[model samples]
Target: MTNLDFLLPKSSPTDLRSIVWPRPMTVLVTAPHPDDFDAIGVTLKYLKNQGHDIHALVAETGSGIDKVYGAGMTQEEKRQLRVREQTGSLRFFGLPDQNFRFLNLNNAPDDQVVDDEANRLFLEKLIRQIHPDLLFMPHGNDSNRAHRDMANMMKAIASKVEWPIALLFNSDVKTIGMKKDFYVGFDEADAQWKAQLLRYHDSQHQRNLRDRKYGFDDRVLMLNRKTATELGIREPYAASFEIDIL
Candidate 1:
């Protein structure tokens, strides 16, 4: 027989399973926009598979649709469509409507400079109510202004909280660089499921095509593949995160 053992890298004996929270923990995943959840879909799916209770919070309705979809549709119509699409996407992951919340904050380019205190308070209230053991948000170094703002807002709220909470930052498409501390690997089947979930964001698909010929599905696959390769993992795809204890 061929020297298969030598060809494969030696496995480490260290048990790193403790890095992830044990079963039955509550997780809160926050996204700057409806479709942003795809950035951390692999980890979310892994957490769900482990029987963890998870909730998704979207910071905005993605009101900049007119810039992407053109002037054909009204803002209200676009908003409603995005809401429906996100709802359907979450449903695919077995999340109930009650488990998903949308802040519906304005995402216009001009309005991006201002931070809404009311929205922060709303998020804090939700965090208090959920009392999640683990919280997921976009990384601070994300190139997207809204993503950076959301990270700052979460950090502010996390500073105010007294109890122990694990904060994990997911990588966005616009993320410049991140010091990844943890990773969740997924097989081809899981990657396909993630792609299917991304397609539920019909509005985002149109926007992605307008900007890039590829959609969220392709971007996610490429990101995950690159992440897996960088980490030297055998999985087809992976999602990386930076962990912090607060």
Candidate 2:
């Protein structure tokens, strides 16, 4: 019933090659934090290579991350650091800075997303303006609170919108579980490139190292490798996603 409906059965999760959308599409990727976008780099790269118009909407400044790791930094400084890292990562992938945007959404612990009218209206307006055929975001069942909130917010907004849109929910470091309805398989070279993309957020990388005994890059790739092996993908790594139409 949607413009993207054609992608349904044609795009199966078992495919080993890159995704081939029926036509060029406008894609909006929602990131709860700066580095979340890079968590699914290979898939986005494939979409970009297929001539799709891709834009990133970062929902948060990731100041909370700094609040934990940055002992003496000002809030503004923390926000700027994350923005710079995200911008540099996008540049590395050949995306123009103009395509990136910061929603600057508030993260008050007491404000539930469904009850936040302002955020709902803001997101509704932004989605209507972009009018994207596909939306990419982290899966809702993630361990990170921000990631879960953003995913639920997007789903809520999508349900009420007039036009139909495809949602590609991705896996992250904290993703509990998801159905792999689509995927992009990559080799060692591509895996290394993705790692570099994650490495751009050095602050997060160091935090991950100190807390998890590995860097942020490895944390992501470990999941990628496991996903590939679990799905019987021939590639050395794979970025899997669960797709839905709304």
Candidate 3:
């Protein structure tokens, strides 16, 4: 029930980060979780090898890694451990420590990321600073609402950005299902390195199966086989992304 509802535009607005991003050559990969970049681990490494400046931004985090990753350990201990793990993984990717910006917003209790003023401000300030030539964010068609919100926010912020940026979706995504559009290749060492990255969330994987209803390590097999298949290979590990070049 509305008056002139059709008069409005289809999309919303966001301020985005500052204008200091790389000189249109650098890339920013935004992840919802700490190790999410692992989903696209090999692909990212390939990009890095290709001489692209890569940046990472995590959207939210728990106080400790344990509670954050369905871990059985104490929240305090898990938090410290996850930080150390992600830190190490970040270093392995050759990304500068300062580039891993954590938004630290809460999830689980209430998963919806409402596009309000605060989020807008935070995103705007970030965009103003990063000024990325391209941003790899969540896919709009993602099944997860939180993932969808990330894409929505990016689209809204598109107006404030002057540079033409692109967005790439990760393989860990379930909402959009197996994407068939894009694939990046990597060596066996690259696959090994990606698995090492996923190993950082020690607390998340060791959730005593006896006591928990469903507990097991998060395997990158699916990530690898799927992505490898896309590239006409049979590798045990790989990472993929769905691209939206705009």
Rank order (by TM-score, best first): 2, 1, 3
- Better candidate number, 2 or 3, judged by lDDT: 2
TM-score of each: 0.86, 0.91, 0.72
- In the predicted model 1, the residue pairs found to clash are none
Model 3 residue 3 CA deviation (Å) reads 40
For model 3, give the 10-residue run with minimal summed lDDT.
Answer: 12-21
lDDT tens digits, residue span 1-246, model 2? 667766675645745243456678899998878888899898889888878899988854644354467777766677778888888899998888888887767656532122267877888798898888889998988877777878888889889898888888997868998988887888999999999999999889888888889988999999999988988978878888888898
lDDT tens digits by residue: candidate 3, 138-215:
666767666777777777775566655566566563656645444555566765666677665555445423335332
Ten-residue region with minimum lDDT total, candidate 2: 106-115
Please identify which of the two predictions, 2 or 3, would achieve the higher TM-score against the true structure. Answer: 2
| lDDT, candidates in the order shown | 0.74, 0.81, 0.59
What TM-score does candidate 3 reach?
0.72
Superposing all C-alpha atoms, what RMSD in Å does each candidate have to the true structure? 7.5, 2.4, 9.1
User: How big is the positional error of residue 150 in model 1, measured in Å on the Cα after superposition?
Assistant: 0.9
lDDT, residue 14, model 3: 10
lDDT at position 208, candidate 1: 75
**Residue 109, model 1: Cα distance from true site in angstroms:** 4.6
